[model samples]
Target: MEKQLRKQVTALALYQIIGGILGILLTLWVMFRGELVLTQQVLRFSLFAAALFMFSILCGRMLFRNPPRGLVLSLLHQVLQVVYFTFGEYGFQYVAGLRIGFGFDMVGSWTFKFRVALSSFQFDFGNATGQKFIGINLVALFLIFWIERLLEQGKR
Candidate 1:
């Protein structure tokens, strides 16, 4: 049980690092492209998001020497992530009538189907930037999985 827990914690840390790196790269990409299509608030928030994820990576790296220490540190990381995601979604939905694109569409698809007269319909942004973000996230998650596999192998 202890060994398994350690592995899980390590995997979580690896995922955090990979995710943070992707976010940072996205921010840099936006910076170089010289686009002001989004509000300044949005850009600042994106930087905050990247920093938040990096903090998780730092926490994991700092605590890895002791299993118990790492477990405690990781729990704090989890709590911060949960709080951030919850508040972030709430704020986005309150301001933009949506929390992450496709959210409304996904909910509508699940709750009601084939409704031609539903009074409201969700349309995807279908923007190139959004597609780029999706691609980056996908790659980051793949890297996280690869890192987990390597860590698992090392454990054995």
Candidate 2:
């Protein structure tokens, strides 16, 4: 169990570090392209991603210390991720409107207006392709919980 916990923590930390570096590079590219407006958006999104990554790391640490409590924290983290992505996508489609060129049809004017009112975080939700992306994340969370349970059983 301790070994598994250590592995999970290391993996998670590495994931966050790599993601943060990539996000910084992408933001810098946008800035260099002379797209100040897009640059600002990207910067905001990057900051939000950083914050989320930090939260995940904190949760990972807590999970490492206590499996049951960690499982609950992980569940909450997944739920928060879903809400964040949903609203973030909605913001891009509705709030930013056609200005962002997300390569997809709008979700209608009324829905757009409603979403704009909800939040200001914008992200390309894969141009409204489907719920597959979110589904995969949820599934991964479930699998993590299952694996933790199995590991706990082995310890017992």
Candidate 3:
């Protein structure tokens, strides 16, 4: 109902969509490539992506409950950047894990634990994965928004 709440919901939805896409892509990559073991590297990245998705949802919750569009959007951007970094750190781990015959469930849980450990330690900083996601998402979001704008303008 409220604008802030609406925006938060939208952000959460976007985060989930991105996360699902990442998971699917990782799975497909593993299936096609084929490997021996799901390494710690793969586990780590997958976990980070999962954490970032959850963090995005959490950020949305905070954003919607508060006000000021700029601030809320900024918060989203900051969190998204962090998510990207985290995904990089663990992305390879997830892929590696899959290569070793570990199911998504196990890999996903491993990621969840990794997030818990990070949160527990209160160590939140940018990593290589974050940089990767920031760049990719920037371009990807632009394309997505551009397409949406075109459709809207067409309707008008």
Q: Estimate each model's TM-score.
A: 0.44, 0.41, 0.32
Runs with alpha carbons beyond 4 Å of true place in candidate 3: 1-36, 67-156
Candidate structures ordered by TM-score, highest first: 1, 2, 3
Q: Once model 2 is optimally superposed onto the true structure by TM-score, how far is the C-alpha of residue 9 displaced, in angstroms?
A: 8.4
lDDT of 2: 0.43
Ranking by lDDT: 2, 1, 3
Q: On residues 15-93, what C-alpha lDDT tens digit does candidate 2 reach at each position? A: 4344334444444565567756655656667576555545555555665567556556655654443322333234321
Positional deviation of residue 125's Cα in model 3 after best superposition, in angstroms: 15
lDDT of 1: 0.41
Candidate 2 regions off by >4 Å? Answer: 1-42, 82-141, 144-156
TM-score of model 3 relative to the true fold?
Answer: 0.32
Residue-level lDDT of model 1, residues 1-156, one tens digit each, is 367656766766665555446546555666568674666765666566555556655755754665455545555544332211112123211110111122122322432222111011111232222211110112223334544454455456
lDDT of each: 0.41, 0.43, 0.37
In angstroms, give how far residue 156 of model 3 lies from its true place.
Answer: 30
Question: Best TM-score goes to which candidate?
Answer: 1
Q: How many clashes would you count in candidate 1?
A: 0
